[model samples]
Target: MHFSLPDIENMDHRFKVNFINSLSGFKSANLVGSIDKNDQHNLAIISSVFHLGADPALMGFINRPDSVERHTLSNIIETGFFTLNNVTQSMYKQAHQTSARYAKTESEFDETGLIPIFSNTIAAPYVEQSTVRIGLELVEQSQIKYNNTHLVIGKIVEVIVQDNVIQNDGYIDIEQLNTVAVSGLDNYHTTHRLERLAYAKSGVQPKPLII
Candidate 1:
């Protein structure tokens, strides 16, 4: 299906949002945690984690202006700490429920009945049910005025992963975690590893192998 900006004028906001979100299906799923100045905790059910491939492991997520319930942007600015947790199929429902618009005083962790695990280094909490969790510290934040979205960039400081999920060669086997993928707003799906491609820049051709 082909879509154009003009076509959005005739479609409802919900449909447009779904259409755009589906385009991001190829990205990894992540749960972002932040704390407001009042010490109120906030969580963003994110599916995209943009990586910069640099030292300290920089990553980012875009927040929609209209959909953001808590002032997570301000919290990140003040605290410079956040956590990114990987969502699994077992926790998909609870993870998705974190997106609900609750009062700032309420914690999504409590509302969704998901366990919050305190980070060893950061003040923020991560989903205890997640197979993989990373503690992050804010490095930079940029606002995209046209889209009314904030781009949050952070450096990973700590990582926690299930032993079985990590392969001998240091590659993570996502399928073992039974991770869930998000498409659009309310749709969720599971993923499996198809193949593990060889390093193309190693100056040698290797046979492709399926995992």
Candidate 2:
């Protein structure tokens, strides 16, 4: 369960990929949207949704160096508005296809046959088929020199979720939505909620504490 940097460097490419994939099981699928100055729109379907627990409803994702089309970054800089769409099992393939490096003039929504729904609060478009769509405003962006990756932080302005998928306890049921998670490069998986745990500070003593 332990791997040193040297050990990772010594491993084969496939092994390194699998090792990193295992380490990144905590991520979630999120579709990021932005509109260029010329009005061209772009989206990057990402599997990295980290820093979601911070106050002020913050979320972030990493954009790889080679994957830079710059439209999304430019739009965020200009308008400070973007949207995050949570992909479901039914839209998995289409969502994945949006990762293709298409021309700036091309809209991934049009290319993937996904419907673009106008956001009531934000100007950016969101995937209509997604069970959860969030309108976000860009708060900050930082570029990492090590990997040439750009880390974008956004504040959730508005949240839209299907009524049926939300539980009475404020939990969104992934199984109900048939939401899929990504593994490695091409692997997709359906997520199932196994159990719910009480908050650490709830102080509710359980007859049998089990994780």
Candidate 3:
């Protein structure tokens, strides 16, 4: 199954989108929470959230084109703060529902029956049902010239997770939290840890390093 540039470009729009999206493999599933000046809450499910840097604790996510009304993107721009809440096995249905287009005044929390939690550190709301919650402050945003999409980068200001999930080596066991992954546009998947390996070195095969 191979496709050239012309073949891909000529494919059906929906088929092309699904094919291209799935080619990237599993992506991190997160519920992006934001609020407008009026305190109107907005929630959205995004799969593109990715780590940018560790020193600054930076993260980034892609916002689809703003040709349509994008409440979550607008609210984040308005407030300069947002949250990335991990979608777990129990809450993925509600998390995916947040992707639906709703009126700016309508709160996805209310619409989807998901509880919203708040913190003193940032104004954005977090998913109370999520086991891993991260509050971030918007640091930079730029439009991708090729696709007209926007890349939103944020600095991690706060992380809410159970202490037991953190390993002694600074690794958080997301599998213990039942965090789910996304594939294509709507498929949700649970992952299994194959094995943790020691750092690779030249002329040396890595060995299992499970704690």
Candidate 4:
């Protein structure tokens, strides 16, 4: 179970990738949708999405090394708009299919069995099947010197959620919508609400909220 850097470095490439990805535990599964200048749509499944800040509603995700051409990344850079759509049980199979290398002229939404839905103001498209969707405007991008990977960040400009899942305080009930999770590359999972707890204080023992 204990693996030093040398041991990890010596492991098989596929095994090492799976091990490292799984080590991050469960990650959010989303389909990033973007459109090129020609209006060709692209969708790619990514689990690296993370929240960066709330004031500007910023979020970021790690793009893999840029050795290969990434259509989704390129389109986002070109148009400055992309969407993060929650992958549900029904759409995960199609979502995973999007990872396959498709030609730049082809749309993953067309290759897979998914449909692309558009909004009035945003240039990018969203997955119509997703229960929770977010539109973001590109703000910052940083290149990781060590790996040649890029850290893509954006500010949330739009949101779409199933009305029944929205809470009074603004939390979305993901469990109710059956939003899926990704473990490593191929393994998918379902999650449940263990409990939402109140903020911990010095003297007040942390307790679960009864909501």
Can you give the TM-score per candidate against the true fold? 0.88, 0.84, 0.96, 0.96
lDDT of 2: 0.79
What candidate 4 gets wrong by more than 4 Å, as runs, is: 66-69
Residue pairs in candidate 2 whose N, alpha carbon or C atoms collide under 3 angstroms: none
Error of 3 at 48 (Å): 0.2
Report the error of model 2 at residue 98, Å: 1.0
Q: State which candidate, 1 or 4, has the greater lDDT.
A: 4
Of 1 and 3, which scores higher on lDDT? 3
In Å, residue 3's CA in model 1 sits off its true spot by 4.0
Q: Largest TM-score belongs to which candidate?
A: 3
How many clashes in each candidate? 0, 0, 0, 0
lDDT of 2 by residue, 1-211 (tens): 8878899999998988787877766557778877766777777788767766647889888776667345677777888899888878898899889888888788987899988888668888888888888888888899998878899889989989878877776667767877778877667888666567655555666443253
RMSD of each: 2.5, 3.2, 1.3, 1.4
- Model 3 over residues 1-211: C-alpha lDDT tens digits? 8889999999999999899999998999999999999999888899999999999899999998752227878888999999999999998999988877888878999999999999999999999999999999999999999988999999999999999989999999999999999999899999999999988889987899866
Question: Model 4, 1-211: lDDT tens per residue?
Answer: 7899899999999999898989889999999999999999889999899999999899999889642238878888999999999999988999999988888888889999899999997999999999999999999998999888899999999999878878887788997898999998899999877889987899899998755
- lDDT of the candidates, in the order given: 0.79, 0.79, 0.92, 0.89
Q: After superposition, how far is residue 175 of candidate 2 from its true place, in Å?
A: 2.8
For candidate 1, the per-residue lDDT at 194 reads: 63
- Model 4 scores a TM of 0.96
Better of 1 and 3 by TM-score: 3
Per-residue alpha-carbon lDDT of model 1 for 1-211, expressed as tens digits?
A: 7767788667888887777777755667778888877778787688767777657578888876777534667777878899888888888888888888887788888788778778558898778888888888888888898877888888989888878768777777777887777777777788766678776766677767544
